[model samples]
Target: MRSGGLMGTAALALLAAPAWAQSASSGDGDSFLGGEWQPVDPAELEQMRGGFEMPSGLNVSFGIERAVYVNGDLVANTVLNIPDIAAITPEQAAQVADFNRGRVVQIGEGNVVMPAQMAGALVVQNTLDNQTITTLTRIDVAVDSVATLQAINFSNLISDALAGSVSP
Candidate 1:
């Protein structure tokens, strides 16, 4: 198909422009995305002196002097020490739960049922694998809908079956 038009030339020119060309190196120019620039008032400088502090200790502080959560004690004690499990998505968690619900038969044991603890460990392994995949795909958000939830659950099951974790 032959395509020649002024609109096409204009579109190409716009696409070729650098994303940051409109901004000044000092950031004084108007925002390319449309916004007004207002300088920080010099009078507010004195009030900013009490804004924040840099801790000399190794520990980081969230600056919540008073706990407002329902589990105030737990929240205060665990906030800093809490592990970042947010990296795992709700879909991955649901997949792990569903995989755990299925019956597991140990191979070479003549279809003997696996012990509960051993089954739990296998479920955990599958869950960890799911978390790794979801992390790779950057989908570490809550599963609010059924379709998305099912997709992640099925993905984990398929992956486990393909990897020989489950029998055909």
Candidate 2:
């Protein structure tokens, strides 16, 4: 048979296959494939945060204040401190702002998962090599109700995993 005919036959065979044969199934009649969801412990969460490493020459620092399971979702509050925002070049500042502007930021070195954004807050959830880190930036506002600075929240999942991977 010609290559085109062979391809068509294969496609027909796949189309004819029953749905049950294509889907995941356990022998015990349960359709679900995985076990029940369990909350991650504090120690393990810390380990994940340790995995995240900021790029070198970024000239910024961050700290994870807290991590808690809210409605089965991990919520981490982090503070990213920019001591000398003026010291950083405009390009570097733009890079940081752009990092929070996307749903997923890929800097060619690592993946930054930003799921949502709101007034003065950026929600980051990153999972690399089976380690998951979710963070929520805690924003600080000035006396005039104007937002001034923002922090990057790191869960143990990111910090521990990225430990030694980032340099000052």
| Candidate 2: tens digits of C-alpha lDDT, residues 55-135 | 432222332233333344664333333334446556546545654443332223455543453423444444335443444
Each candidate's TM vs. the true structure?
0.17, 0.19
All models: lDDT? 0.32, 0.38
Per-residue lDDT value at 94 in model 1: 54
Where is the poorest 10-residue window by lDDT in model 2?
141-150
Q: In candidate 1, which residue ranges exceed 4 Å CA deviation?
A: 1-142, 165-168
What does candidate 1's lDDT look like per residue over 1-168, in tens digits? 123344345334444443444443236455544456455574453322212121321111121111212212212111111112335456545544644444332222234444565543321113122122111111111112334334544565577568785565
TM-score of 2: 0.19
Count of residue pairs whose backbone atoms collide, per candidate = 0, 26
lDDT of 2 at 124: 43
Off by over 4 Å in 2: 1-70, 75-79, 89-95, 102-137, 140-168
Give the winner by TM-score: 2
